[model samples]
Target: MWKKTQPLSHEDIVAIYDVLLGRRPESESVIENYRRMGSAAAVVRAIGQSGEFAGRRMSSPFHHYHASFDAQEVMRRHAAPRLEPRDGHLTNFLGVVIHSKFLPGILGDRAGQVEDIPIPANWHADIAEWGAALRAVELARDSFTMAELGCGWGCWMNNTGVAARRLGLKPHLIGVEGDPGHIAFAREACASNGFAEDEVTLFHGIAAAAPGTALFPRQKTSGMEWGLEPIFNATEEERRRALAAGSHDELPMIPLDEVIGDRERLDLLHVDIQGGEADLVDSCIDVLSRRVAYMVIGTHSRQIEGRLMDSLLGAGWNLEMERPAIIRLSEGAPLTLVDGVQGWRNTAR
Candidate 1:
């Protein structure tokens, strides 16, 4: 009777069949629940908006996009001792103000990265997770050095150093930025944090790729925030809000190969240059291929998702673990960045 008196359209019929036959665990049951919940467009749209929606895509809707790459492919692309799931999350979100008043103005003339750094409890949770990861890598390696690419105001570097101290690890810290204002702020952060001279490096301009004419898009409509809007149509005001929270940008314009001497000696690398991962990765092909022990990247490129796994595989690296790039949402619901935490590593390295 149920099959004979169905009102579901041909498209819906085909979709249900596809989900039942070719999709995820308990696809038949999930589809049944969807049917019971009502086959309204609004329902589907709402479901699409939820973080659970992508999980469905990764399951049932995957056939439409990703050709089934086997477990070996998954391992070959994303398997390693990643930096941590919570890397730079707070820094990218709110490190500026936290480090702004605290950072020293006279940098390159100070000692350890910084002191007297403060963070809220919630923010500190993320900081703690990331800091612990950084320390683990630093302790495991010899002569640890880090480059904060596109580092604005040195907030990420400064907050990280302070957080590291809390975690009881002190590796060499550097702030690479093109903005003089941020460089000054970073210096202040360092001095305020009580960093001794020679312990911190501040590479002002021309990092890892972008040489001259560093362009920062006014902290509004940044690819980092705006690229996320399509799923939920985030406006420019939110960019302003994030900017107000201090997420300025100065992409690393030089190649790691050209700048750093040895890749093997490098420990943990933190990269947050808006959405410039493609160019950055392309330019630092050797570093991405050689050293790159632990990495945390925030990318919005659809192109990256399609080819990212393959790119890492070709470099002989594998994606070992990953998690959702959870973004705080307000207007309607929270938006969890789909392509999240693809950690790749090479054991043979």
Candidate 2:
């Protein structure tokens, strides 16, 4: 339905190279070289054929042509462990090797698909998604505040830190997780990944509408995959009954404003609070409108997804991307609900 109007001018080609490479051409001679190549396509081929781009291992994952972001240095930092590059997956996963310079790395566990770690099956999709997220933050600001609610193992935090550092920005990162054990693990992971105490901070509480107690499912001793954990806004009697039954753990639920008091501006916020996304967004709409420039929230239900879409759009945030989850009800039944990550950027403010 759509087609290119005309060949891109030399200036246009150079601009594209600048955005993809994150830097201007070395000299005017580079532009002249591209000009001598004739068409835009030829210029692109000439650039790809150059030794500098060739050394970067130019790869066009979705196309036949090879393209490079000039991110070899960052990619080397995310080299797969020895156990990886095998048939299946690694038992002890360390970090993800994303080829996009926008996101340098993602520290996560391979035992289970915890964070966006590259796998033998979905490594390309993983790299594209994580890289897009980091690119969103990069476009929003060079240096600014960032926070991750439900910061599972601090994978996104590390990714943000690494990307920001490469961009010459010293960003302050905050990690908030309701899981006590996860909070400890996240702290250690952050420290191990070169984050100093002053550069990164951790909060051990669930982010809710207000400061109060919320019922969280206590992790079982054997497994740690509670990606669908929910926080209930239950009555005191209900809370007591759950505690008496020894099923749920009582955790302090604090609002984002309280935890991030007086931050002034939050450039980006990544929230994956399992099923609590809708309630948390509703409860902290004011704080979000005031401080947050961009938000990427993971939803678990159609109702939650609609609520978030309405609330953020009403507050002047624009939807940037959405990846919906699909699951079958039974062996032969149709998929029931759609839920996944939704990205929004505040375009008005």
Candidate 3:
């Protein structure tokens, strides 16, 4: 049976480490650090700084263990020897080496199905079109500041970063994510991929209309929804229920007005906040219209698609490229196409 784990206290951490290291902790020092930091994350940091934990990098044991467990489970269920970890990484259906947990055939049940088609291959033409659109918006020749909201695991960031670097553009990348698990994985990936901490700044929070805490849907039914829309704009009733039930967690929500700040120009803003991009964009029209030079948005619904098109068009932005909306099918074929990933360039600015 799955048992709920309790929060670890100062004494618990000290006692656990005492047993592991076979030595007693300096009680006064441990208590002082605990009081100063006042969180499990801080306790982990303190442990990393100690002589015993030297060279250990502060990587969470929970993260590694969970990744391993998920990988093994996926491999076993799918009976996919090819999907097994090779050289310490799983080459997913997209041919992208994912160093984290992955679920095989999550795209579809049968091999060679439309969903089984690797993403990079299936979207190769669209990718070219997207690049062309970016070039048309004058991103090809200039250094730019790019921001990605809901940047899960930094895949899009890595792709864009490499492209920007190849173009001799000094890309200032900022990623905003709501999931703590993703935040940690992205940070590790950035480090492993040789990205300087200063080059790619990441904030562990959801993008919304304001900078504050809000109740988020912490319980997920699958991994696909990990970086999906968070319920930051919850109703009073929903908030009350969440608070009473204590099943969900509240996370920091940052506004785009605050993210863009006093910067004279924002070269590109890629929004893939699951289904919440409309709310985020709608909330910061003034800043987005005046400062953002280009944008790529992933619309989750026709309503969201219409709203984005109307908003950007009203703001004097030109639509460069777009995919039309798609409907789901319950028959012989899968709904392989979706009308999302629209591109726009601000011409008025």
Candidate 4:
């Protein structure tokens, strides 16, 4: 619905920076320079072609394939030893082997199949998530440290860690999940991928604003449940009742600050904690800005996406890429059909 020929206004120019560059203008002079372009479309073109923007794009591991989704070319550039197709393991395009037992819900269908180099469409994640997570690894120095909250079988950790290892960088991975079964899966996945015990840590808990306990639903079927969120603020008696009822288990809640520990630099923080992502990120903005270099968050709603933009951008984080949540009309209100994805970079880091 955006008009290309619309005359640029002061507010519109500011929004251009927020939407395109993911930050506020440096000064009035910068806005003035953009205003001289006269049309919104011209300003957009200028920003999109700028070296800063181009540099950000080039940082992604998928940079070469962005222009053309040529999966073969990408595999050729970043190939590992071709993995043998097996019944319980599937190799991704990056040659990272994944365990079939960790595939959740419909993703389990991929089990026991021979996986060729996958195009972006066939991949589990969209381009933005793939680019963001891998970009964090690409930007690492001699060492790469990453943590994943709500990490299902440590998928991102293993994938990104392998990418970092390929570049000769030492990788330290951390995974936190509410499900104990998934935590076991994470441990198995990491070990299978050749990470030493000292290089990997798995936590059976939830990431929250503070340390506490939350009620997480006990999954009856392993690998069949996904998107399970913990119920915060449950009383001790309620948690006991739920536990006795065989429906939920009390999980330790660890704050982001404690999760990262004394790590001087965390290359990536991947979060997909269902609908609680915004609040968790907002509460840990200071830690995020100081320690974490990049983030790829799975947003559950449009409101969550907006809150994330407001909180992170307000704290000087750049919006590297984003795909808004898919919404559909429902009886009560609008419902999110599919979760949105947002990739953020902390400029202060």
Model 2 lDDT, residue 343, Cα: 70
Lowest-scoring 10 consecutive residues by lDDT in candidate 1? Answer: 222-231
Q: lDDT per residue, candidate 1, 282-338, as tens digits? A: 666666567666554444444553455566667776554333332223366543222
Task: Give Cα-based local distance difference scores for all models.
Answer: 0.42, 0.56, 0.54, 0.73
Best by lDDT: 4
Off by over 4 Å in 2: 1-129, 140-142, 330-339
lDDT of 4 by residue, 214-264 (tens): 898898765645567689998878877999998998889988888899989
Q: TM-score, each model?
A: 0.49, 0.62, 0.61, 0.76
For candidate 2, write residues 154-261 as lDDT tens digits: 657766676666567777888877667667666766675567889888887777777777787765541133253545678888888889998788878767887676
Poorly placed runs, candidate 4 (over 4 Å): 1-83, 104-109, 112-114
Count: clashes, candidate 2: 0
Shift of residue 44 alpha carbon in model 4, Å: 31
Candidate number that wins on lDDT, 2 or 4: 4
Return whichever of 1 and 2 wins on lDDT.
Answer: 2
Candidate 4 — worst ten consecutive residues by lDDT sum? 60-69
* Clashes by residue pair, model 2: none
User: Which digits, one per residue and each the tens of the lDDT, describe model 3 over residues 51-74?
Assistant: 575434233221121111222222
